[model samples]
Target: MVKKLISVGSILIPTVLTILIVNFLFDIVPLNIQGLPLVLPFVICPIGAVLGLIGYKMNRDNLARAGMIFNIVLFLFPIAFNIIGTLSGGV
Candidate 1:
């Protein structure tokens, strides 16, 4: 059970923390980022993509594949967030 917990955490914990950190950084950073401020919110996908690619190269196993796939999904999370927000009456 401990191993399972640790294994699950190895991937999820970093992803969640990285997401929070990225969001905080984005919010505080200036909006004058040469127009990137409009698109930088989509940065999460590349972040997860890179993590997945790294995991694929280093781990070389099912877990690595899982990481890669989840990274892509993670990348989409921002878009999903936007959609959900709009649906829920958020701006």
Candidate 2:
């Protein structure tokens, strides 16, 4: 269980957090910081894809399981974010 958790975290944590970090650090829409805006959403896809390939090569079983976990996260996070945004009047 622990290894599975760790494996998922190894890939998902970095991929998702880096997406958020780049957005926030670059001061994307609604952010108060001064910097370049993300004119395109998929601009960061290469980074995530490279990391995903690395994760895939690390261990097939681990990567597969981690991917399932990440998909669940991918499904849930947006709903949660939407709810929060709606409540906060940002929607």
Q: Rate the local accuracy (lDDT) of all candidates.
A: 0.54, 0.50
Q: Which ranges in model 2 have alpha carbons more than 4 Å from their true place?
A: 1-60
Candidate 1 per-residue lDDT, tens place, 1-91, comes to 4433333443674476445646554665444334342244366446545655665565465664665566566556556766986999867
- Candidate 2 residue-wise lDDT at 42: 33
TM-score of each: 0.46, 0.38
Q: Itemize residue pairs with steric clashes in candidate 2.
A: none
Q: Pick the candidate with the highest lDDT.
A: 1
